[model samples]
Target: MNLYRIAKWVVSIIFYPLFRIHVIGKANVPKSGPVIICSNHISNFDPPVVGITSPRSIYFMAKGELFENPLLGKLLTSIQAFPVKRGMRDRNALRKGLQILKAGHTLGLFPEGTRSKTGELRKPLAGAGFFALRSNAAIVPCAIIGSYKPFRRLKVVYGEPIPMETIRESKTSPQDTANIIMEEIQKLLDLHK
Candidate 1:
């Protein structure tokens, strides 16, 4: 098995037992084709939670800092994570994201850009929507609740795929699309509560 699969199995085994993980709307994730998984950033645990919960392998645009450590960076890269410099245009990273989507892979993105220390959702950065619109990939808004604490029951809710056609027809700007994605995530949060 590949590193991604190995990591997924190991993480699934370790994490699920540590915390009660409840995954909802698994059917909402497309079985094939490119997809954008836009999730709320709660904690570092959020990535593994979402990654293992999904049925398919998901690639992530992780912060550049994580790639600074030689060994850890290699491990992360083996699991399909690329680095992105936060708080800048980071054109190279964006191009790599677009390439991933165009190649029909699921690209995971924390639209909020950084972890929310308070566990509350924040405004999304434009990159998520820009990639979604540019790559014409379906957007899946995922809300992860209560995973910030160890041994707490964690809930991951995946909302229905927002079609690329809908986004295109809306004629909204990239920033607006990002806002809409965040809004869907907020709705999922409300529903779960």
Candidate 2:
């Protein structure tokens, strides 16, 4: 098997039992096509949880610093993660993400630029919306509840795909589109409470 799948298998094996990961609304994910999986970032574990829960293999946009360490960088790279410079414009990262979508692949990204220490949803970066608008890809809203800790029940809920039809119907700003996506994610979180 490919290294990406291999790593996913190994991590799923370990993570499933440790966290008791539970997923809902998984049927909302499209079977195939270029799609963007937009989610809230509460912890580092959020990415893997979303990626593993979805049936499609998702290429994640991760922070560049994670690739600083040689060994760790290689491992992350092998798993289909590309680095993005945080706290800046990061045009290169944006371009790479668009390219991934244009190629008809699944790209996973957290709209919240950074993890929330308090596990509360934060303002999201506009990049996810920009990607969806630019590539005309579907955005799958997802919510991950609870902290990423061992022996705890972690839940991930996927909302229906937000198609580009909404964006095409109007001249929506990236920030506005982002807010719409975040609203969907919030609704998913509310359902679990």
Q: What is the per-residue lDDT of model 1 for residues 7-63, given as tens digits with 9 covering 90 to 100?
A: 999999989878888899999999999999999998888888899998778999888
List, in order, the clash count of every candidate structure.
0, 0
Q: lDDT (0-100) at residue 44 of candidate 2?
A: 74
Compute the lDDT of residue 66 as modeled in candidate 2.
87
- Runs of candidate 2 with Cα error greater than 4 angstroms are none
Per-candidate TM equals 0.96, 0.95
Quote the lDDT for 145 in model 2. 86
TM-score top scorer: 1
> Where does candidate 1 stray beyond 4 Å?
none
Q: Point to the candidate with the largest lDDT.
A: 1
TM-score of 1: 0.96
Per residue, candidate 2 scores C-alpha lDDT tens digits across 73-116 of: 99888889999998888998889888888888999988888888
Q: Relative to the unseen true structure, what is the C-alpha lDDT of residue 105 in candidate 1, on a scale of 0 to 100?
A: 91
What's the CA error at residue 74 for candidate 1, in Å?
A: 1.0
